[model samples]
Every structure is written in structure tokens, then in C-alpha cells.
Target: MQAIIFANRTGNELAPLEQYYCSALLPVGNKAVIEYTLEDIVTSGITKVKIIISSQAQEIEQLLGDGERWGLDIDYFLSKPEEKTAAVLDRLSLSMTDSIIIVRGDIFRSPCIANFIDFSKQFSNEFVQAKMANQNACMLLLPAALSYLDGIDWPLTHDYDSNSVVTLILHGRCHMIDSFQSYMNANLNLARNDIPSLTPMERSFTSANPEQDFYVGAKTHTGDLSLQNAWGIIGENCRIDPNVVMKNAIIIGNDTLIDKGSTLENCLILPHTYVGEGLEVNNSILCKKLLISLNTEGHIEIDDQALIGPSEHQASTSSTDRNLSTRFFILMLLIASLPFCPLLAFYALIRVMFFKLETKPLIQEMINDNLGRSLVTYSFNVPTRLLSLLPQLFLVVTGQLALFGAPAQIRYATGRNKQRLGVFGPVQLLLDEDAPEEERMLLMLEFDNTHTSTKYLSLLWRSLRIPRLLGAERKKQNMTH
Candidate 1:
């Protein structure tokens, strides 16, 4: 029988992580979440499959192209997140006579589909539901039970043929990952080998202590690991420095670096992150400088590069530490703009007095002080877009905002994202103001990825023209109106 995998979730639950990838593509135990789903579908001996996707469809398609390697033909259908599941299934015209397995591709589940299907063979013509204690993992939809798709919920407690229905408890684990806390717990489950279906890469590196157990990948340096009753999986090309103490459950993703004199316990380190020297990291997901606490569901990013940063930045030209020339450039702008602050404040005062404007002259916003390293809040939000933002040049001076990188400018937003605001983004300086959002984003990435001294000065010169540009644009708008 054919299977339909629902991978189209918006996955607002995964946040921050969702910013980079769709939930199905997120890395878990060193494998994409959907990869395990594919393994289960292929292992269950189902060939023809359909995946429903919406946002980031291109990345998902690039990852699971045609599903040829698994000896299966795969087709993708687009669906809005809010659309009813029954409507999408009804549109598929799946068959009235045959049974099909329906699974959520974005979540992680244990007790492989093959085992679940084997145990579920007892009932021939009824709705079969598989679940752990509180969550539903998946379901087998028989023709007789297909009619109740829209109204069904777990407990199979009501409105079904009581005698014909079947509920099988595989006594396995299911991680719906409906929240970040659940997502962190899923990794803990993997570390503990609680999910039998997932085989986290080969356990290669043997620890120094007999009590220490580690599953390490290729080219990893575990020479200095001092573990006391600790066990975990670490990915490829990692560096675990000397005098480092690791304990309990840990999952370090590929291309990570755990520095000297640091203590890590019960933490999941995402790939390309650098844990600082001599710091204690525990019970959290550490990515770059960002630390997300699993216990409290709170997150903090440390800006001190010697403490925490991106792995690549630790070894190379760091965006966190600004160069002397860039600092000088920011100083020059700050000196230029400091004079205008009082005038802008007076304007704001007048607007408040006569125009009944309720907004404060300046509003507080939090931003990454050094790229994405540390978070700092500043007063940069003003009602006026261009001239009023002169007061915000101090953020660039303070290294909280970039002069020539990423058009994240509260200084240049053509959109409405007041959250985590900053100023003096050079997006409009590098690309046409009317350029498509995708093009603007690409340009910003270029600025972000490669901010050479020569390039920085070129963009700085271009920024000088913003006043005339803003004036001309304002005239054009007035004429149009």
C-alpha cells in the first residue's frame, strides 16, 4: 500500500531553528528528521509516497529528490499550513478500497514502522491507531475507518465501532516536538538510545575512562576528554580540547569545538558552534554564541568571543571583533550624527505636543551586539524612517549594528518587523531600493559573508548618498500621490 507523509508543517514551534530550515530538514542526532521518516517508510516496504510541503519547499525538494535511492517514486504536493488535513487527503483521491499509512514527517517516533505494522496486522477491516502514553505517533487508515478522518482524536474513545476498533501500544517513544522543550527532550531520548528506530551514526571513538562512553565520528580530537559517568554522540571534524570535563548525556554536532578548561554536561551542541574556554555549559542547546536552556526554555547569547562564538569565527576573521578601521568608520559616523540628535528629539517633542502622537521619541529594541554573539538593547525605534534614524548611528558606533552589512536596518526597512530592531543597515546602499526581497537578501548575505576593508569603504561612500536618495524618492512618491 502507498503511504502519504505530511512534511508540510509550518513548525512555528521549533523557532530560531525553524529560521534556518523547515522542521523536516532539522538535524537531530546528526540526521535530518525526515531521513528517519524515510527509513521507516522504506523499511515498512512502502514504495509510492507523497510529501506535502509549503515554505522552504525548494530545500526539502533538493534533499529528497524523487526518492530514487530508496527504490521508490516520490511526489510532492503544496499545501497551506492552515488547510485541513482531510481536504488534502481527499484531494489526493487515495483509494476507497485499500488501506494506507499516514505519518507526520516532521516529528520523530520510535518502534520502527515495520514493528508497528507487524503488530497491527491482527485487525483487517478497522481503524488502527498507534500511540505511546500521551501522544499519537501514526495511524493505519482502513477503508471502513477513512470516513472518520476529520473528527478523530487520540483515545479512540468515542464515535467508532467499539468492537471493530483496535489500539496497539508499542510501548515506544514519540516526540511530537510541538515545543522547543520537547525538541530538546527528543535529543535526550536519542542520547539515551530510548528510540530504538534511530541508530545515531556508528559509535567510533572510545573514551579514556572505562566509565565514559562516546559515539564519535571521523577526524574528531577526543584526546582530552575527561568524563565521569558520561555518554554521548559527537559528530565529524570536531575538536574536544585538553582539560575539558564532560558528564551525563551530551550530543555535539559536526564541526564543533569544545575548548579547554570547559565543563559540558547534559547539553546538545549544534554544528559549527564553539563553546568558550573555561565555561560551564549544561542542559541546553548551544549554537554559535546562542545558549538555549532546556530546563527554563530561556535563551541567551554570549558576545565575548573568548567565551562563546561560531567555530569558524574562532579560527578565522571574526565578525564579532571589529577591526580598527571599521571602528574608526563607525566613530566618524557617530561624530557626524551626534549633533543631529537634539534636533530630532525637538521634532519628536513637537510632534508629540501638537499631533497627538503617542509614540515615544525613541523606543528600546534588542539586537546582537557583535553580529549574533551578544544581545544588547538600545533606543533606536523612531516613527520617522530616514532622517529620524540619525540618532541610531550610535548603534553602529557601538558595534550593535553594521554600516555595510545586512539590510536589517531599522534604518532601511521596507517591511514591518519591529522585533529586535537595529539601525544603519547598508542594504539600500548596495542594491536598488526597488529590488526584490530575494535580491536584497542575497546582497545582504554577500555583505555579511565577505566584509573586506575595500568593500566596506565602498559601501560607506555609497551610504553618504542616502539623504539625496531619500529626498528624491520622497518627491517621486509625492508626485505619484
Candidate 2:
């Protein structure tokens, strides 16, 4: 028998989620929601299958590329939006084929396809339906039962079944993402392993002290957190602060960051998101700048990424907030700042020669320079940040750095090198050289992710307030010491 997966549903109800990915592409645990369906097909030993796709169809095709990774021969068909399953089968000339196992790949399904197939193979003249404990979301059809296609629906709504239809309420599970609430519940349940044998990927379960049920993916940086009847699943390459408090079932997606002093409970943080410090997030879905709170039934778009935002790569996407106007304005700022180079150079020379300042700062340190800038370090005997930036004005003239681009500190910071180095970024102003590595990283990430022309202009103006921000930081460091 062959398998057919109708994955064309756009999942309009999954609003904010659709902003990033279609519902089928949404990550659950560590895999996309459709991956479970594909795995089930492979488990059933179905070799040839057809996937119907629409609305970001390229991404689905890219993800499921020919199904060779799963050892299945697959064909892709781009169907029109909201096309009925029966109409698609007709278009593909697959209606008269032998018994076909139809799978809806747009939602979460974890049925034992082989078991269902074995149980229903005996009836060649009747429609067979398989159900989880609560709902009938998957079904199969016999060769003789192909005539019943007119009454069935795209999703497995079995309203057309009559007395001849056999319904098996098996142990399989199907979690619907009809709304944001159900989507959150499904993810939380999966994180807790509430659905048996349904989790696609396996993470290392650690029992280090209070972190009893902590399931973490590979190469993730995290520390132990006390849990009370709670579990946490962190995906690959995530940086979770050591002091983070995670309660209840939580799912942090791949390449995510959870900054220090934050509290996460019953939440699903999407991939490439940066959760800032001291954020007490509970029962919410975070996708870049969009925060969907369960209680409010609405989303809040945060303008300041220093609080919460996307990661470096995700930053360059929609949340980057960089456009032609902003770039043009930055160009104007660069042109405007050029005239000051002579005076700034004179001041730097004076400071170096007399004010007990040394200009032998680092000019050769490498921190992920995507710009291919020439090596020029700017270190000083004393920490004269104002003087240090003078030499970098030359870099700005040559486009080595944005007028207000995100920059890495030449001396102490180990912030992610992927962030662009700017002449003035929040990380440079808000953090002292003695601040914790986590704090620096979080600030730089926020700046790199959401830096716009306006933010750049503000930071330029805020140069006057550097004494205050840095003084405050120094005072905090002094108190800590």
C-alpha cells in the first residue's frame, strides 16, 4: 500500500505562529509537527508517497527533500490553497489507485500506522477509521471503500461514516492546533512526555541534583535549576543562563537563549529567540518580538530587543528593522561624522600625549568580522572609551562598521562573534568591562538583533550620557565587589 499526506493547510488560526512558520512546520519538542507523520509512514513501511503542499510550500519541500533521508520515495504536489482532499486526489490521478493510507501532515499525529493497517486490512469493502482515546483524527480506506471519498473532509472529520464504517479508538494521540491555546497545551504536554512514544527526538535526561527531569539536547549550555513536578526540554546549541528558573513543562527551541535571572514556566520559546534577564514568563508563546500570552489572548510586540528579541541570524530577518531609509540615514550620519574626524583625531592625540592615555589598545583582535575589515586595534593605557572610538571613525568612513552598528568590545567581552561590530551599541554603553559574560552577551544580542536607524541615532545622541550609564555600571560593579 502507498501513503498520501495532505500538507497544504495554511493554519490561519495559528496566527502569530504563521508569522514565522506554517503550523505543519512548527517545532514540537525538537522536530516539526509533520515529521511525526512522515516517521509514522516510514514505520508502516510505506515506500512511495505523495505530499501535497501550499503556502510556504518551498519550505516544506526543502524540509522533506525527496524523503531520501527517511528511505522513502516521495513526490511533491503544490496544491491550491484550501483544496479538498478528494479534489487533490483527482488532480493527481490517484483516486483509482489501490488502498491508500491518507495522512494529514498539517497537524500533530502519532498513531501506530502499522498496527492500524494490520487491524483494518481485513476489510476490503468498508471504510476504516482509527481514533485516539478522545478523537478520530486518522483513518484508512479499502479499495472498495474508495466510493466514500465525497463525504469525508480534509481533516479526519468522520461525519460521513455510516453503520458500515469501523471506528477503532486506539492508544494513538492527536493534538490539534486549532487555536493558540491548544497549540501551547500540545507543546507543553509533549515536553513532559505526556504522549507515549510520540516524542520524535531523544534528549539526555539528567538527574543532577534538583534538576530531576531535565531533558537537554546536545551542545546546549545550561545549569541546574530546581523543579517541582516540572520538566524542561532544551533543543540543540541553546545558551540558557545558569541562574534561570524553569518550572512546569517547558520547551525551549533550537539555538535559543534564556538569559540570567529569568523564570520560565509552562511556556514554549520558539527557535532563535533571545529571552532577556529577569523576565518572568509563564504560560506564553514567544516568537521573536511577538509575545503571545495565554491569559491576554493577544500579542505584544516589543520594540526594545534589549528586553527580549531574536538571535543574530533571526535578527537579520524581519526583526532586524533595517531598511533603505534607515540605511540611508546611517549613511548620512556617517557623512556627518566624517567632518569631526579631524577634531576627534586631534583630541585623541592630545589625550595620548598628555592626559596619561596610551593608544596601544588592541588593533589585531578578531571577533567574527563578516565585513572583512583591516586589522586595527585601539587599546589605551587608561579606559578612555571616548578616545578609543576616535580611530574607528575611519572604519565607519570605509563602511567597516555602521555609524551605530553592533560592535564587540576589543578587550574583555566574549559576546557572540556573529553580531556585527558597531561604533556604538547598547552592549558598549550599558555594560562595564567587569560585567558578567552573560550580561554582555545578552545586551549585544539584543542590539545586534533589533538595531534600527532610529536606535542608531538615539545611541549617537546618547553618547553624551555615556558618563552616566558607565558611571552607573561602575557603581554597580563597586557595590558587587
Candidate 3:
């Protein structure tokens, strides 16, 4: 039987994580979601397969190329966004006499397809709908005589009524992973040895503790780490710190590092991530720059490179230069502010004399000369706001701040000290100061994560517009009062 697999379905349900890869390419255990479907088809004696794909078609092509690894004759066809599954089949012009099996690329199942084929042949029916629970497992057996029905505008559901009799096959082992929770659960099941063993692929590294149910991929290093009541799967070339502890976790991709004293439980850490020291990551998915919570289905982008960042090998030199340039720009601003020093002093004296304003010394954490340390500074009240800020500009000259970075508050300094504290930044210039704290934090984190030298001109423009923006905001606030 020939197989027709629709691999183009958009993965909108798995947002954030879907931003990086197609749904079919999502890693389950040692293999991608689509690989399981392919293995099932190949095992069931289907040698000729047609894969219909869209979006990340090239990525899928590069992965399954010619299908030689599975000893199948594979052909790929690109499908349009507006086209339905029926239209895709018609466009491919599959032979009328070919006994065809249709499968959805995103579904995972360990089905004995030969049984389904045999069951379908006894009825001489046009279609056989295989139902696992209430959902269509995306598996359909179409008799050769009914190939002309491929153009029918029907959804791939059990609700279809073909000209011939429809046979139903109930298979409970099939799973449809349309969300982050389902995806994580599937992998967790695999790690826990709850599911049947998948076909093992070749590996470079041996399991540190073969006694435990674990799958360690090629070139991975356990480094004296121990698993407890968990089945761990570490991808190729990952470094697990000796002090780290894991229970029922799956780490995919390559070149990841689990830092010292970190504990992970039922978490999925994507490739090239660095889990910082002493972090307790539980029931979450850590993709590049994003942390998705499995329980709440909420996600956050971690812009702090030191906490959970790209691998060291992927760190670009341009990022280093951009940071250095920010420091230089801050130093220039401090020099320009020197003339206003006397005005600041006079204003401070007026505030103290009339407003009874008292300046309090504050010890603030700062990134000085590329090192993290505390700096002694004076706090300013509302009446002396601008005046008190002048003395802090010296921090710019001393390499403690960036002209266009985060606020200098210690609470905002929790992440990696790589980002320079600044007087004004994209978050401060664009977002209302009265906005919810969580919203503001998310925006700032996103800004820090995506900002680069390419955004230098934009940052400069925003800096120039800050005075006008703040003036308008102040006017608006006064009107509200």
C-alpha cells in the first residue's frame, strides 16, 4: 500500500515553541513526531510514500531526504494554505488502483498498520476510518476503486460517509499532541518507560547508569550526575554538572549545559540552553529564549543570557561589541552632562531648603567595568528627581551604566549583569510607567533578549525622542490630576 502523509498542518496550538520548528519536527523522545509515523508506515510494509508539506518544507525535506534511510521511495509535494486535504490529494494525481493509506504527520501512534489493512480488505469498502477514542488518529485506508473520491471536500474526521461501507478500528495507543502539555506528557511517558520502547538509534555516549531506564544520546556527558526515580534522556554533546539533580526529565537538542546545583523535574530543555546554577525548573519547556509552563500554559521569554542562554559557542562577538559601544555612548553622555552639574547642585539645595527633601545613601548593584558589584549612590525624591539623576550620570563614565539599557534599580538587576543599567531604554520610552509591573517586566525582558547592534540606530532614535515622550506623558498625567 502507498502512503499519503499530510505534514503541512500549522502548529498554532503550540505557540512560542512552534515559532522555532514545525509541529512535525517537534522532538518527542529520541526522534521527531513525524519519524514515528514514518517508522510505522515502513514497518507495515508500505515502501512508497508521498509526504505533503508546507511552511518548513525544506526542513522536513532535509530531514527525510529521498527516504533512503527507511528504504522507502519518498516523494514530497508542497501544499497551499487555502487547499484542503482533498485538494492536496487531487493535485498529486495519485493512481486510482493504488491502495492508499493516509496519515497525519502530527499524530503519534504505535499501530500495527498491517492489521488495519487486513481488516479493511474483508469489507471491500471505499474507506476505513480508524478511531482512537473520539478522535481520528489521522489514519485512513482507502480502497483503490474509491481514489476518485479524493477530491471530495470533507474534513479528515470519523463523520465522513463514503459510497462504500466504512469500517472503524479502535486503537487506544494513538496520541494526538496538539498542545505543549500533551507534547510534554508524551515525552514524560517515554522517559518514565510507560510506553513501548522506540527503535533505538546509534549513539556515541553510553548511559552512565544502565540500571536505570534512561536514554543518553551520542556525545553526552553525565559528569558524575545521578538520576533518582526518573528516566533521563540527554541529547548529544550536553554537559550535566556533577551536582545537578534530575527526576523524570528529558533534555533534547545538542550542546546544552545543566549548571551546578540545579534540579529539574519533568522538564523539557531544548537544545543549546544553559540552565543556571541552583534553579529548580519543574514541569516546563525551555526552548530558545522562551520558558513555557506546562501547568498554566503561560510562557515568558528569558532575555537574560546568564540564567538560561544560548550555548557559549553560539555567542556572537557582535553582541560583545554592542555592549561595549553602549558603555562608550554612556561615557559620552556623562561628559555632555558636566555643564549641568551646577544646575543640579542648585536645584538640590532648593529642594532641601524649601521642600525639606532629605537625600539617603543607597547601595545599588551595578555592572561596573564588566564586573558585577555594588555602588554607593544617593537617592532622589520627587521634587529633586532630575537634579538627583545628574550625579548618577557619572556612573555612565565609570562603566556602571548604559545610556540605553535597563533601570538602575537593584530589583531589575536579577538577571545576567551583561545588560547595562540605563537612564532611558526602549521599555521606559515606549511603555507607560503606570502599566502593570508584570507587563513592564515582560517587555523589558523581551527587549533585552532581542536587542542587538542591528538595533543601535533605533535605540539612538528612541533616546532622542525620550524627552518629548516623557514631556507628553507628564502633561497627560497633570491633566488627569
Model 1 whole-model lDDT (C-alpha atoms): 0.67
Model 2: per-residue Cα lDDT over 1-481, one tens digit each? 8888877777777775686787678888878888888888888889998888887775676678778889999898888866877788878886465778776777786657788888778765667766775765645564655766543355445554546677766774577777888787777667656776765365656533343376678889887634334576778989988888877767888889888899987888988899888998988999877889888768888877776788653343443345444556656765786676666656655656786554432333445455444545453222445444555555655546655645544332322334456666666555555666666655654554453668766655665556337647668878999
- Give the runs in model 1 whose Cα sits over 4 Å from its true position: 118-122, 150-164, 208-212, 226-229, 303-306, 315-481
Ranking by TM-score: 2, 1, 3
Over 96-130, each residue of candidate 1 has an lDDT whose tens digit, in order, gives: 78766667788877746776667656666656766
Question: By TM-score, how accurate is candidate 3?
Answer: 0.59
**Backbone clashes, each candidate:** 0, 11, 0
lDDT winner between candidates 1 and 3: 1
Task: Please estimate how well model 2 matches the true structure, expressed as its whole-model Cα lDDT.
Answer: 0.69
Q: What's the distance in Å from true for residue 407, model 1?
A: 15
Candidate 3 stretches with Cα past 4 Å from truth are: 144-166, 170-172, 197-212, 225-229, 312-481
Highest TM-score among the candidates is held by which one? 2
What lDDT does candidate 2 reach at residue 166? 76
